[model samples]
Target: MEHDGQLELYTAVADQLKEAHARVRASQVPEGVRMALTRKLLVITAAAKHDLADAARRLESFMKDLDEGRIPEEDH
Candidate 1:
């Protein structure tokens, strides 16, 4: 039962990650911003391997920022 719940959460997060990638790709942001966002997604993806719940929270915050037009500055 607990395992099944975890599996469902994993599946949902995976699907959300796919949609987030697509949204990033289709966004009209500058290249640098896009790259930064991609890096963030990559980190979230890696985190999911070790901590699904944490990764899901991170991904949710990321998506919320994106939806709210709160993009981070590009790294130097």
Candidate 2:
């Protein structure tokens, strides 16, 4: 059913979010950069409440950036 599919998607996103958090924490980036990344993740978490699919897409893009070494510069 559609409900079941949504539940699965939610579960998968939740798991991915956890892994993403761990990755950010384990990353060697500077503290400011890590904090910014954390803020982005938090925004994605909040967005999931209203638009889960969009949140998942955002999270995926975020993870891809991390994996590809595309870290943002730390703000002064």
Candidate 3:
């Protein structure tokens, strides 16, 4: 991905995570609302966590290459 595209994607993900977290935190909402929002939050949280983990793995691989005095390449 281009640098700008990557930044935009990350920003959107962050905004979604914040919104989902807030929805889950609103305890005054009705049970039905809470249930629906909790599901949404869980889905988004899982997705975001997955993305983060992948990024971490890539970074680790890149750092390992750097330590071995080699340039890292894109995973894809």
Candidate that scores best on lDDT: 1
Number of backbone-clashing residue pairs for each candidate, in the order shown: 0, 0, 0
Span of ten consecutive residues with least summed lDDT in model 2? 67-76
Q: Per-residue error at 1 for model 3, in Å?
A: 6.5
Give all candidate RMSDs, comma-separated.
0.8, 0.6, 17.1
Per-residue lDDT value at 14 in model 1: 100
Q: How much lDDT does candidate 3 score?
A: 0.53
lDDT of each residue in 11-61, candidate 2, tens digit only? 989999999999999999889999999999999999999999999999999
lDDT of 1 by residue, 1-76 (tens): 9999999999999999999999999999889999999999999999999999999999999999999999989766
- Tens digits of per-residue lDDT for model 3 on 7-76? 7766766665565456347546556655654564555556556685444344444335434644322222
lDDT of 1: 0.97
- How far out, in Å, is residue 27 in model 2? 0.5
- The list of candidate 1 runs beyond 4 A from truth reads none
TM-score of 3: 0.42
| TM-score for each candidate, following the candidate numbering | 0.96, 0.96, 0.42
For model 2 the local lDDT of residue 13 reads 92
Q: Rank the candidates by TM-score, best first.
A: 2, 1, 3
